[model samples]
Target: MILVGAVVVLLCWLLGFWLLWHIPAPGEFRRRAGRAPAALAVPESIPLSVSVVIPARNEERNLPCLLQSLAEQTRKPDEVIVVDDHSEDATAAVAARLGARVVRAPDLPSGWMGKPWACWVGANAATGSLLVFLDADTTLSPEGLENLVAEYRVQGGMLSVQPYHVTLRAYEQVAAGLNITLMMGMNVFTPLGDRLAPSGAFGPCVVCSRADYFATGGHKAVRSAILEDSFLGRVFA
Candidate 1:
């Protein structure tokens, strides 16, 4: 019985691998060709004004790292807006010290989730052509912003990135496998990712044109959703 179970598991793994391999690769699946800010040859004619929005609640510890990283971006955003979502900690102070424009998130209204409401507030305050929504815990590489802009110009739609897990604790390392499985289960790497169904979006980082974002009603459309990021992706699709 043990041997039979082992064989079944191995076969299942193989089948899963085969399915993943056979799926059509989306445009966003391309390798990181531009590794530095200078490497991204954005056309001078195309005016790309990016506004980065971060929604934080009691994220004082994590907010600093993200803000510092953003400061180091090769292709710097025109502005960074950090929405303080009623944080009990020094999240607002940290963001302000880092030179980010801090905005207070209004009291959560009925039928609105915290994160989405904060994001919506930030989006409304943003004045850039492109909006880059990033979580407080996310740290970007110096070239990350440049690469994102390059990719967006090529893909011409919403772009969501599933960050590479950098884990220190053993439990976190173990959880990484589950995270990958969840992403794969949603068909994130397949062509279906471009559609509404059987698709996924990573909430940690998302970039899209301001026009497209508002066209889909932004987070306001998914105000009550528990999985606002995933639902927002579907709305964009």
Candidate 2:
């Protein structure tokens, strides 16, 4: 009995060691990304028009950074729409102050999740060839829009970026780290590429063509899905 107990403890210790050793530290990721050039001009022939959509839900604290980021983007979006998703805070005020067209979303539908429903409202109001869905908490670099547009125009399909997620608290740090690992491991790099399998984006920076969005039925088709980003990607595929 003693021998069996000893072996079990040893096995547990080994398992714990393996798990700890493989868990990537935050520093392992290349967080220090240089900002893309501010003036990344698209070819004049295409004349791609872009609509930037931001969904805010009680995000008064984070809205300023995002607005500033949008203002600084080298390739300005033709339209910027901010959908206040039943926010009790001053989200609409902040967005309107930044010159974004603020739309107040009605109460969420029974089957839809918060963010996706908000996105649905914004998408319906957008009038650009390209639609960019950004989260309220995310801050963009000055050239980020230009870079994404260049990639989307070239690729001509859905494109997403793994933005540098910043967190202040310890729990937030751990969650962010785990989220990164899951994304990298789940083969999300090419969600709509050669792999016909379904995958999801982080939802912070989802960029896709307006044509492709409607072709995939848009968020209305994925109303029931809690993870609408994954549903949209599969529908596009």
Please report the candidate that would top TM-score against the real structure: 1
Error of 1 at 123 (Å): 0.4
Q: Count the backbone clashes (under 3 Å) in each candidate.
A: 0, 0
Error of 2 at 113 (Å): 1.7
- Once fitted onto the true fold, the runs of candidate 2 whose alpha carbons sit more than 4 angstroms away are 1-44, 188-198
How well does candidate 1 match the true structure in TM-score terms? Answer: 0.86
Tens digits of per-residue lDDT, candidate 1, 82-172, equal: 9999999899988999899999998999999999999999999999999999998899999999988887776557888878789888778
How close to the true structure is residue 16 of candidate 2, measured as C-alpha lDDT? 45
Q: What are the TM-scores, per candidate, against the unseen true structure?
A: 0.86, 0.77
Candidate 1 error regions (>4 Å) = 22-44, 190-198
CA shift of 54, model 1, Å: 0.3
Q: Rate the local accuracy (lDDT) of all candidates.
A: 0.83, 0.75
Question: Which residue pairs of candidate 2 clash?
Answer: none
Candidate 2 residue lDDT tens string, 1-237: 999999999997775454333332332212211224332233447778999999889988988999888889999889999999988889899889989999999998898888888999999899998999998888888988887787665445677665786778777777776665546443423323234353665567888878888878778888888877767766765
